[model samples]
Target chain A: MSDQTYVTSDPRGSITQLATPSRLEYFFTAGTSLSKNLRGYQRGQFIGQRCPVCSKVYVPSRGSCPVDGVALTEEVELKNTGTVTTFCVVNVPFAGQSIKIPYIAGQILLDGANLSFMGLIQECELEEVRMGMRVEAVWVDKEDLVPSLASVKYFRPTGEPDAAYETYQEYL
Target chain B: MSESPEIFTSPHVLEFPYSRSTGPVIGSFLTALRDGVLIGIKGTGGKVIFPPTEYDPDTAEETSGIVNVGPGAVVTSWGWVNQPLKQHPLQHPFAWALIQPDGADTAMLHVVDAGSESAMATGMRVTAIFRPADERIGAMADLIAFVPEEAK
Candidate 1:
């Protein structure tokens, strides 16, 4: 494809610049741990793996613990409910972004999982998204389920009292 | 608990998702390629550098002056692809070569359509074959591939 070029006047000579566009596509395998996690999502379950050395459970584990550098061999079933450990309001937009502008992207610490994962927080005003806010996964219809994170729509406030900071401080 | 299933595989697009600015020096070189001309920049030690850069690779001094170079080049080394990937420039078997244009001190990487691996060799001369004028868009893809000079 052709690049977009711009010529601007300058003291010495006209300056020339171009925006080069490129793309690539390939197959990505969701190895052992993640394959189980995604398949669990299809069944409306949240499956995580526990590292034997550290005992930290990771949702969508990439087969091993990042800190311990050992295989995560134990599978733990976790609840969709979690606490918003930290979050940011996304006001800027970019290409291929699916959520509307001004949405909340949050780090969620799921119940029974030792680590947190990012998820979209919705069904509340931007100012209402807090570090300890309780949230839960809102899944798509069962018939529409897929073996991917997309099976869960956005997470929303569970209306429960905010989780105490002491409960999720380690995640932050 | 049931045994874990086989690992899942899905199509993925590893995209750069961004465009980069080709500054003045590279902009000029690509612009010329779009115009059906191959060019080089004068570098340190009186060497011509193809696919010109802003600075000489050896001395790091800013490059100066432009000169028309090959349509003609010589293959310095090459690797043969028995089966091409989806992203490969050519669909059939081809050789990825380190080619030095007639007067260039540095070699540029490009593909050679030598028809068969048997036809490829070190020191073989090749010439650039450009895409049609209208199809060019100020990029390296403007030069489609090189072919053996004897067959040109």
Candidate 2:
């Protein structure tokens, strides 16, 4: 009964449109053993999963050895210091981006870990963020810590000379 | 370890950047919302599917006719959201409703902005509330919500 027609010849609006925005939030159970390890970050400690078969350490435990195909059942204390085995300088800005332009997001192999995990590199220039550069976690205040990687705001250069390429070449 | 240790879980929000094109029929439907009109396509058995689809919902048959269906309609079924979520059409308390707009034989899901739960009911009349004219961008959001007919 309304005068709303199906078509409009008016050239006012664009043909392609942005759909309604949406977000998803969920916190699934990762089990007590996993939670304990992640919570260590909040306490200014690093914990890694120790593979019994290969004796390789994995930070933020994978719950199992993806390589050896067995439950990685042991936990070991790890050092916050690590080497940046590889990295990329991010230049593009995204809708929800937190890091600034020309920031480095790198893969770090913690001092006592064999597996490499990704994290942001900050407090240093992009040109200075390099492979084999020794870096340490620049944590958010312990009071702000939650059982999340966000506790580590980002990693920064520890002022140690770059590690010998031979030291982390295998990681590359 | 046989004894379960405290396994921590944290919220990992993964946002993937993406953009995609909507094909012709569905494309026209959203385009109509942009211009402040509600369109429906006639499907099999003369049933109209609001938020027009390219294909018939039941039979998957090709459909051709486009018809104007709303601005006023009736709530077929509704449930009150005591607390609205960010994704909900309205930020405040409102009722999610399945409404059959006038001239349509089928109901389409939309939200009704009745101020309180007490104001909603099955078969209650509602009218479309478009996003403010200058602010409207072509999307489902252009047709923001429906309000109790008398309040319009």
DockQ, each predicted model: 0.35, 0.26
lDDT of 1 by residue, A1-172 (tens): 2222323232223225555557766677788888999899889899999999989899978889999999989999999899999999999998888888999999999998888988999899999999999999999999998888888898999999999999999999
lDDT of every model, 2 decimals: 0.85, 0.80
Each model's backbone clash number: 0, 11
CA RMSD per model (angstroms): 5.6, 6.4
Instruction: Give the per-residue lDDT of model 2 (tens digit) for A3-118.
Output: 22245675863355344334466766767556757778768888778888988887778678888988877888888899999999888887877766878889998897887889
Query: Which stretches in model 2 have alpha-carbon errors above 4 Å?
Result: A1-18, A69-73, A140-146, A158-161, B1-5, B11-37, B41-66, B69-152
Error of 2 at A106 (Å): 1.6
Docking band of candidate 2:
acceptable
Per-prediction TM-score, please? 0.79, 0.63
Quote the lDDT for B54 in model 1.
Answer: 79
Q: What are the per-residue Cα lDDT tens digits for candidate 2 across B25-96?
A: 667777777778888988888788887777787998877688888889999999999988776778899888
Alpha-carbon deviation at B41 in model 2, angstroms: 5.2
